[model samples]
Target: MAVDPRGVDLKRLLAEDSGEPLVMLNLLRFAEGGAESYREYARRLSETFLPRYGGEVLYAGTGSTVLVAEDGQSWDAVIIVRYPDRTAFSRMVADPEYQEVTRLRTAALAEAVLQATTPWS
Candidate 1:
């Protein structure tokens, strides 16, 4: 099933098969406030990036992990998205939506790291 972070559905993805080896990642970060730019970026992504990435997001969501650190003390939300292949992920980041909104995301995020890994099943 697709459960990367809290974005989309998994079973409908095209680039990956549930039984095949999949890449998993855990995105860790410290972001807060619902009104911040990152939230807007997320909204825009929900509107733009999601559709743009399409199938790539499905493969990416499976086996993904997201963690939000302490509330008021520091961190906020964590995100993890899957990709059928590292190359596909690389391409997605270079896409126009990512290129623009990513910068906005960084500005809102205090600390973020994309932990891309392969999980053996």
Candidate 2:
């Protein structure tokens, strides 16, 4: 489970850019005592990095009462973030300061799914 993006991942994301706003869906499964750590990471992201990189968190919430899913498919949390473009997202991940902050997220997640989405036309 990858909690952080690698250089090649960023490169690939940029390569697939369509010059449109991108929405990223995050499904997180936390490690032991990881919720607090993730909260700290989220704090830094909302306060500094998101603003610096032109990104906004559209939704963030803890998962509960799974209506439909296979066993072990439940997530501890979910987040939706929108970025002006793929370039902005990649740049944020590449930022030296953001890289430091991202460590918290890495330590907080046992498994994660970060998927980019596009609006239906």
Best by TM-score: 2
lDDT of 1 by residue, 43-62 (tens): 67667765565422332122
Candidate 2: tens digits of C-alpha lDDT, residues 42-112: 99999999999899999999999999999999999999999999999988888899989999999999999
Question: Using Cα atoms with residue i matched to residue i, what is each candidate's TM-score against the true structure?
Answer: 0.53, 0.96
- Backbone Cα, N, C clashes tallied per candidate: 2, 0
Q: Give the number of the best model, judged by lDDT.
A: 2
Q: Once superposed on the true structure, which residue ranges of model 2 sit more than 4 Å away at CA?
A: none
What lDDT would each prediction earn against the true structure?
Answer: 0.48, 0.94
